[model samples]
Target: MNELGLNFLDLGDSDKLPIILIHGMALDQTMWTPQIPVLKEHYRVLTYDIRGHGLSEVGDAQYTYKMFADDLKSLMDYLEMDQAVLCGLSMGRAIVLRAYDMYPHRIKAMILSDARSEADSNETKYWRENSIESIKKDGLENFADELVGNIFCQFQFQEASGSGGVNSKHRLIIFIRGISQPLSSSQMMHDKIVNSEFKIIPKAGHMSNLENLEEFNHNLLEFLGKIEF
Candidate 1:
């Protein structure tokens, strides 16, 4: 839709509620496929490939989160969607969080999964850049191996066989350090938004939604049910 040429999937009737699902880094709109069936039953669900992530065009200019947010607005305008429930995982959540600043009224609610809502620290930023270089120097498979290992072994939310639980910031660091960071490091966003929910899918990592789709969908349906009440 629009000149941006974002590849998107729209499901359900126009008369139903609207829900937009935004995916994280290294992921495409298909990441939300498991949730679409349940969501489309009651709402018109919109799933799009963000620029440079999937099939979307990658332009020369370096972009900011706000630019991504603007692209969302452009798409919304094209679709004549006034407001919708926004659900994002990791970096996807950050983009929508920025969108709230420019168009607060456009969001009906937010679902922030496996992401913080604060600005990135210099150390975290540096570490990610370093990790990217490592990925390039080493190999994509190795990088994936390390990432998945970290998630399964060192990054479990609840206490598990070999993993540790993160009740405080110290243990949480392992989970937070990644390719797709959150919006900020403080609860300021939760306070600012007023109508938001944080869902922690246990036994899962940064890719929590994908790792545990059953529980994820259960929680999601419950959340949406509440919104209707």
Candidate 2:
């Protein structure tokens, strides 16, 4: 673990460009198992658990986007990396965005899976509050079942604004079922960012990487090939 109490695996050659993979909420770095072996061959791969998850220490401070972004920056500084490619999933996507906002120059590029870039609406906030209440009222098992039920349902398509901005021109947006976020967000991001590519892994849900590892990795590698540093 680094100075920030982040449990991480630094793989691949030290001289190579870095790729940081951030997992979704409630998930640890192991979620990126499928991509590591392949990615490590070409780039320096860094996979770590966010604070309060996996082996990482849970500090007393309330967890927020800024806190997570700061931790990411600290890790990069500790690794002596001036910049790196940030790839994230689900809540991890939000962290990647926040990190870029905080330290744009440190981000060489981004690969976002199941991406979303908008403030939570009242309905979304209520759903999250209810989820917390459900975990407290019911149990982790029940909550897991309910969450699975929600994730595996038919994909619901929604529209979102492309108002979010990023400093980097190179980005790869990947998604499965357009649930939990609007499909237009990807389109807007692709439209806004130069050298950006948008891709979809068919016959998959939110966990598209796990559901269709081949296609996901293909899109990821193809995107990486286009990047210069």
Candidate 3:
């Protein structure tokens, strides 16, 4: 893991083709743990924390999808990645969409998971505002604990509940630990989430990757496989 310019976790053989993985808001590179082993078997996997979320330096500028997209582009340029498949979840997906819109030639294909392109509904926006307030008031630690429980399906929750029922709890602990650091500026991210123009994954909430991992991964791999390398 390097945090010099952009905080990233580089895994697998560097000589292999590059694949960039972008995590959603309130999440860091660890979100790709499930996919890393599978992906690294075929390509060089690079997972990074977006600015303000992980070990990356929280810049003075407000967060925006365009800024996030620019960061990815800059990272790719810095690393000399000519073109690579960009896979993102939630906010990460928005970043990739903006990146494609800004620099289409730099991206070969994209995997958008559990994310939306359109702005959130008034209800959803209210929820986000409440969430932001909760995070600010009670801190991310407690908020993360409450947040992860709502991410999975009831069936999944039941299964987890049956097996000593701590997966979600454990995952939340890890997630909260990662994001417990101070935020740079969430105003841009908050605004973007509230007033996004595109909503790609209508069925998914925030944690679409985990809720529908199989389907999501299948769609992602299929898209990547179809791309002409």
lDDT string, candidate 1, 33-85, tens digits:
89998889988999999886678877776767888899899888888899877
Off by over 4 Å in 3: 1-4, 161-208, 211-216
True-vs-predicted CA distance for residue 144, candidate 3, Å: 0.5
lDDT of 3: 0.61
Error of 1 at 109 (Å): 0.9
Clashes of 2: 0
Decreasing lDDT order of the candidates:
2, 1, 3
List TM-score per model, in order: 0.75, 0.85, 0.72
Superior by TM-score: candidate 2 or candidate 3: 2
Best by TM-score: 2
Residue range 1-229, candidate 2, lDDT tens digits: 5567999999999999899999987678998999998999999999999998889998999889899999999999998999998998878888888887788778888878887656767997798778768878997688887776566425322210222666444444433333333577667666676656678776556777766678788888888887786
RMSD of each: 8.2, 4.4, 12.4
Per-residue lDDT of 1-229 in model 3, one digit per residue for the tens?
4434678877777777677988876779988887787778878888888988878888788777788888898888777788877777656766776777788777765554554435656997698779878999999999889877665445456545011211221111001101211222222232333321122222333554555456445555555554455
Q: What value does the lDDT take at residue 100 in candidate 3? A: 70
Q: Candidate 1: TM-score?
A: 0.75
Candidate 2 has a TM-score of: 0.85
